[model samples]
Target chain A: MYRQKYLFLLPGLLVLVAIILFPLLFTIRVSFSSWDVYNPGLNWIGGENYGRLWEDARYWQALGRLTLLSVTTVLIQYVLGFALALMVWRDLAARRLFRVLFLIPMMTTPVVMSVLWRTIFHESLGPLNPILESLGIGAAPWLSSAGWAFAAVVMVEVWQWTPFMFLLLLAGLLSLPNEPYLAAKIDGAGPVRTFFSVTFPMLGAISVGAILIRLIEASKIMETVYVLTSGGPGTSTETSSYYIYIRGMRDFQIGYSAALSLTYLIIMIVALTVIAKLLVRALVKDAA
Target chain B: MLKITDLELLVGSVAHLAAINASFQPGTLTTILGRTGAGKTTLMRAIAGLIAPDRGQILLDGTGWTRLPPWKRPVAMVTQQFINYPHLNVRDNVAFPLVRAGVAKADAAARAEAALARVGLAAMVDRRPSALSGGQQQRVAIARALVKKAPVLLLDEPFVNLDYNLREAFRKDLVDLLAVETGTVVLYASTDPREALQMGDQIVLLADGRIVQSGSPRDVFANPASLTAASVVNDPPINPIPFHQNGVADFGALGQQAITLPSGAYTLGLRASDIRAGGPHQARVTLTEVTGSETLTHLSLNGLDLVMQEKSVVLRSPGDVVGVHLDLHKGLVFGADGQRAGV
Candidate 1:
């Protein structure tokens, strides 16, 4: 029976090995070798690509930008999402309709959303500039200036993904045990006090989980930047993934890009592990 | 006094509470007795100011409290589920209300400790609610309410979630705790008649969102005004048999002995304890359940099912013929409208 059960899992195991394990091992192998699309030959470089990545100023800048984008976007998204979720969770007329309307942005394709936002942020002929101009503020070169371009990319990322956080946090809010809230009310705690004392504490684990997921996804952000700015105006918004794409596909430095990708993977693993530990500690502390 | 006059509450389209009128005296523990969905919780919520009544006035000491918010009301409620702030320890949980009331931290902590000691949970002050058992969590909730020191305490079936042994102990503890709570009217809602009889100084019987009866517990149990009141106040439920009158002061049942009631169609209600075994009337024992100290014998007499509780350790088997006697003087007679006829 055990042997038959093992046989039943054979096809799934083969697929996993083919799709996940093989590519991972190949990437690790190629990181140490000098291989380019034009050369068509693999040279045993033995850590040369890794050393080159460590010395590259543009690679470090891209890494820094990736960190800035992930942290800023996740933070802004969490605040805005929590506020929206709280508003929609209230007992109001057409609340369900508002919830559904808020989730539409998240349902749209990321690339398509990026294109739409790019048009909206157009410096010369966009609705955003006209609105700002009408408000007596001058039109901003949203997609042209380096600072504005980065801010634009972050805004698009936040706009597209904040709804996902809203949905998760809304579910967390709705499923919270009702008794504690009632207790708070009877105890004469006002709305603000109840939120800080009871609601926020109960939402700890879910908030941490949402932030972790958004952080992981944000760290790999390339599509929005690629569509909106394309790391233009002197590589201001070049995230690590876009930087790797530039090296591998645009510059044909496949081995160097592979090395950079491995380093990115390691950093993500360490960061996620640290965050998971902190969340577990928080949960355990709450339990205690 | 907490008085509700012409209280009408509508939950969506259905009338949850209709024309409810009752006045609860201060320093009395009034148990709202009813079955599930009998509007006991709704009444409690209305009194707590958690929900508004459609067309009624709730007065606390002659001041209208119907429009007041829950936080402004001088009331605290303990729900069926044990609700404690999971992240806060027992002391903090108990002190939360006081802290929110703008009491100083030291004063709140002192009062919280005193309340915990009152609930016999002072030793577990540092433990979180998750670390405590269900009974202990409820105690923490009670302590929280005690710390609030509200003039009115609404407990909505707070002991329903505990085990039988814990429930018994908690019931005693709750009774003792409320004993010394001067000037605070406690409204305890429960479906169990035994709990009402044990804990209530006054029992308010509700059925179909209407107040069927209200009086002292013993008086309400002994003379339930209607069939609904009798059914709500009886543990094993009152055995109601269809009674047909042949003539004046002559009724069917009791082996042809006529009851002294007017000639009419009626239903006779008898409590389990009032139906004795071994008398003149004969009945066949269908089932016998011995509960250590007493035996509950289910008997079929004249094609009517009757439950009799006896103290003797008699092992009456199924199909055994037993003489059943009913104390007719203690029996209840209900007319067509399910109300007691001729008092």
Candidate 2:
């Protein structure tokens, strides 16, 4: 029986080994070698690249920003998403229309949205600054100031990703049995009490799952930030992906770039493993 | 303590309903009887505050509840789907309302245990809903509703999905348990005639969203107000034989007899159990099903398929040429316009 089951899964196993396993192994091997674009030859550098990465201030700053972005984005998305889901759920009159409207931003291409936001925050002739100016308020440079630029990137990232969280959490909310809510209501529970006691506890699994998925996506987000800020304003908004791109493609330092990529990959693996363990715990508790 | 008056509801512009005014005396079990889509569920939902009527008034102890939201109505409902929280253990699911009411953890636990013990699920407190049998899950739902202590309980076909024996036991237990709560009013809905007759003290018969009749179960079942109510409130049905009034009901095969007519063309309604076999009336047996205890015999009698439920030792074979008899005094007669005739 086990053999038969394995036979059925042979195609998937082959695909995984070919696409994922092989590439990962190849990348790890390349990370340890000094094979720059100039010299199309590999010189075993051992732990030299690893040692350099530890002292790289730019890499550490980029890593820190990415961490901050991932944490802040996940937190914001979870709250905003859950709130939106609750609102949509309670307001049955416009639920379908609101769901479709919320999903529009998520469906739009990230690159395209980034371009649109770029125009809107263009320091002058942009919609936001002019609106502020019109309101008798001083207009601040949105993407030009380093501090403002980082904030803008975080805000835009949250906006594009909030809908993803909402859709996921909404599915969880909608799929929940309506009985608990009714029971709570019958017990004379006010709306707020019912939500905390019934809705939030029941949705823990879905909330964790949504956050983990958004966290993974946040760590890999590239196209939007690349197009919007280009990791400029003294690399204040620079993420790991942009830093890797700057080393490999712009500076032609493939060896250093490959080392950085490997480091990021390890960080991701550790983060995902921790998150997966927590998710499993949450799911098990829910199941129990 | 609950009264529903002048309730009218429309379902998404597709169906319209106008349920009759009904009241439940404290601690009384009022059974709502109807066919599918007869607005039984809609009426229950309206009372539970799950559905808003385009026009109506609901009163709990004479207080207007129509304007109150579901949370304020003090009503608990167990739907046909058996509403229990799947993620929570049986204990937590039962204690859900208590916990929400700000009962301390230990107190809530004690209450949950008591409710579970009442439902005979105390040993399975930690079990999830999926692990429980259909009947067990239903008990958990009941336990949860019981723990809520709502004065008005609206149950929509709570026993619809349970096996016959379990259904009977749970129905009995539920009626008995709810009976002890003097201030609570239970409105139970069912499409089953047997259940309605056995469990209902006061029965409301509905057809096409209108209350055809409302009275004691005995009265509604034995002397229904209309042909629809007669058919709906009896298992094996109070069989109706069409006949032109001619100032008498013509039971074609049983021979013509002068029967009193209230008004309009009338039909004779005979209870299947009241019918007897081996008479002069000639008819062919269309179907015969022996269900261990009794044999249900059907015949093509005067263009209507007449059913006779009898405790016969020997089951009659289908396609048998048989003679049937009717106890006319035991059956009702309905007028052509569907109203009860002669009473």
lDDT of each: 0.88, 0.82
User: Residue A71's C-alpha lDDT in candidate 2?
Assistant: 90
Question: In angstroms, what RMSD does candidate 1 have relative to the true structure?
Answer: 3.9
Clashing pairs in 2: none
Measured with DockQ on alpha carbons, how good is candidate 1? 0.59
lDDT of 2 by residue, B118-163 (tens): 8889899988888999999999988888888888888899988887
TM-score of each: 0.85, 0.86
Ten contiguous residues minimizing lDDT sum, candidate 1 chain B? B248-257
Residue A258, model 1, lDDT: 85
Question: In model 2, which runs have C-alpha deviations exceeding 4 angstroms?
Answer: A1-23, A33-41, A81-116, A166-206, A249-253, A279-288, B10-19, B219-228, B241-253, B256-267, B333-343
CAPRI accuracy category, model 2: acceptable
Instruction: Give one digit per residue, the lDDT tens place, for model 1 in A1-288.
Output: 667878988999999999999988888888988888776456788999999988999988998999999999999999999999999987878999999999999999989999999899988867999999999998999999999999999899999999989999999999888778888888887788888888878888889889899999999998898999999778999989999999999988888888999998998899889977887677434634
